[model samples]
Target: MFNYHTLYAELLSSLHGSPLEKWLPLLPEQINQGLCEQRFGDLADWRQVLQQLPEVSANKIELKDKIQIDGDSSDNTRAQIKNLLQALIPWRKGPFFIHGTHIDTEWRSDWKWDRVLPHLAPLENRTILDVGCGSGYHCWRMLGEGASRIIGIDPSPRFVVQFYAVKHFIQGGYHGVPPVDVLPIGIEAVPQNLQAFDTTFSMGVFYHRRAPMDHLRELKATLRQGGQLVLETLLIEGGLGEVLVPEGRYAKMNNVWFLPTADTMISWMRKCGFKNPRLVDSATTTLQEQRQTEWMTYHSLEQFLDPADHRKTIEGHPAPLRGVFVAEV
Candidate 1:
């Protein structure tokens, strides 16, 4: 909806209008005088509040045409994403895997922030905490976009490398945001005081935790007044369905987690003291010759959704996810 650069342009234009009438019109009105002078300084702070309003201007955004398609196979798709990530930031090595299996652009481009970021309120001057921030894709992107500070916590040591790799490789990758510090421990280990943040985002990380509630409490502990949590993860379809139990791993994919329906997951978020938790987008993976979500890696489209293959066993238990859930605290 509202383009950052475009809005900035409007402010610049307004400032340069006819000096006599323009100055007269720009002066604060009677009731607004105190707010403009005491609360917002000049126009910058006022502009900041205007931008963060919970309004959707648009879902589409324009990015410099840097994407090059090598082909749509799994290997080629991964390469394209790696290059895209590199182009977004700088990385000497490739982008290591995060928690999701749907890494490909089935829904949105890796560089595509407009579709999701608009739904998330800004954190420019606020503290942001990301949980299970595998490789810190969300964390790093938020940093580059303009969060005041970012703290990423993941269990894997390799996350440290992936967390910083993109910024190391891409030109103008960090944008105007502050640097991020990634921790290699679980959320439980984060210092309690630093837990309070202006906003927090956890993606592809929460479902894997053994104790979802404890971690949710920890997540809530980090939020200050009027704060929000933007969470994204794989989910099931039916409302309040059976809680699937994982007997063993996929053997190949390491960061797998049990899939919960949107209803149950949202219920958990509500229990953790989050208000008005809602699903922003929900979709399931079906057939696609081209690589699908980050979840469909081990199998192809037909194989993943084949109804005959559904089972309690490891090999036939469908793909990593049947649906997706995006919510908030």
Candidate 2:
């Protein structure tokens, strides 16, 4: 009912005659697996809500400023759109504008984008891959920055649906843009040493892996020789050879496994065969950047921090300090 075959066909057409053509055979199987392996019991219900969304043509599509799909619609139509989106609650990584309604998400992903965009190589006409790209928010941003094509991968079925919801409106209104797709798969699902993308981004994902080195190596394999890698993850204040393995949870996130100092991260990147790894920016995540909103009515950064000392998490670990690093393959 989600029509993944159309998307898969589009992906194949986009990869034809490109260096990524090597992925042609394996992609279909992987996509089928991703669809068959969906664990979300509410997927059908979510798909129905998506189907209920009104077909309103966007008079203007603005991605450079914000993810806005603007057009004139009746108040009833706008309300319908808002209600449909509200059903898909806990929108984590966006502040998307549709018609006249604004769906403010949990994380101010634009802030993260601003911090990383300045330090990277030019994205104009480059093949790009975004690992752990939740809801394809940054993929839209990458497209706005003139990427030739963008492939985003995240295993979450809900996130994939959210991406396609946005994509549905964008593709219907805007035409002749480069290919942009989000696959429901993990980094491990990708073939090794594909060496296809001109630029690769792995943000907010490194610390979640138990074997950080293997994750780094996988990222390296996705890039072409000398391609740029944008690595952003949790960091602590320490010298080289220092990393934190949280006892239980860091900021209430159980999946977090490693929190490395900036120097240690650079060292690990070099060890993974990346070249000239350099720390570009390091900033502590703020409550304003990630907080509870109507669209995401869940516990957020404020609830995760220690009441006595805000600088530490509820578990007594240091608060979330994120670092952005750029390296070459």
Candidate 3:
């Protein structure tokens, strides 16, 4: 087993009297529901990998520019660490270096972070909520920038396990476990209108929601009064009021619902009562930023695009162009 009881204990002790204390009563049951074996058959296999990871104390821990952990493990132990981490494949959000292994994920998530970090309010001492944070890569980066605490939410058990794999080394390397956690639950599981965090981030998640306006409202509710909202999502080049409701799959993703213009999204934020919503950064996702790596050997952005035209997806929709917006609640 992966010893989820320990995770629960740490979260309870750390959050007992914090601004997020109210969540302590509900976390255990929610975490259990998210990790039920019947729902995820591979959970046991992933747990076994975690059990088998070599115990090595990291000599250096760096999370500022990259997630790098260096230790004095013997070469044999480093090889074993690499093999164990390989079992958790299709890594999506990181390029974490542990001991001597580089687990380069499909998305060069660091590039996305570089684009968004400069435009936001300072993260120092801020309490943050990262919705749909896969493997908690950005959560670690937030901690590096001096966040008081960070809570990441995602429903996938695989990503949750991957986070703990890196976190294990962090605990061994640092004096104590840092105040960062990735809960195996979605944003919907959070108590509504709690308004606790200083900053709320919803990145690469807005288009997947069937109800776009509701998603904005949900992001708003997670923030304290006058808190900042950092939202990054798919966008199409068009005027105000223009939106793309893909007839079928967009970039071979079936669940994507709405791709809006930058102006349209800003208008929607205003309607949801966000203040001074403005487009901060906008760019087309390139092959270099997202591609197949040895760690993530699956179809990626290259295969999803039209063979004849790089600007269009195979289904003739505009290729993915994402935008980041900052607002105040």
By lDDT, the best candidate is 3
**Candidate order by decreasing lDDT:** 3, 2, 1
Give Cα distance to truth, residue 228, candidate 3, Å. Answer: 0.7
TM-score (all chains, Cα) for each model: 0.55, 0.97, 0.98
**How would the candidate models be sorted by TM-score, starting from the highest?**
3, 2, 1
Residue 65's lDDT in candidate 2: 64
Model 2: how far residue 152 lies from native, Å: 0.4
lDDT string, candidate 3, 128-192, tens digits: 99999999999999988999888999999999999989898777788877888889998889988
Better of 1 and 2 by TM-score: 2
As for TM-score, the candidate ahead, 2 or 3, is 3
Backbone clash tally for model 3? 0
RMSD of each: 16.4, 1.4, 0.9
Q: Relative to the unseen true structure, what is the C-alpha lDDT of residue 321 in candidate 1, on a scale of 0 to 100?
A: 53
Tens-digit lDDT string for candidate 1 (1-329): 33223322322333353221232233233113312334433334333333332211222221222211121235543454444443322221112332111234322224323345767776566667777665555665675466766666665533344443332333122243224555545666554534356777766566667777776777777676677877766665567645554555541344455667778878887877888887776544334422334432334344434356533223545354532334444
* Number of the candidate with higher TM-score, 1 or 3: 3
Each prediction's whole-model lDDT (CA): 0.48, 0.89, 0.92
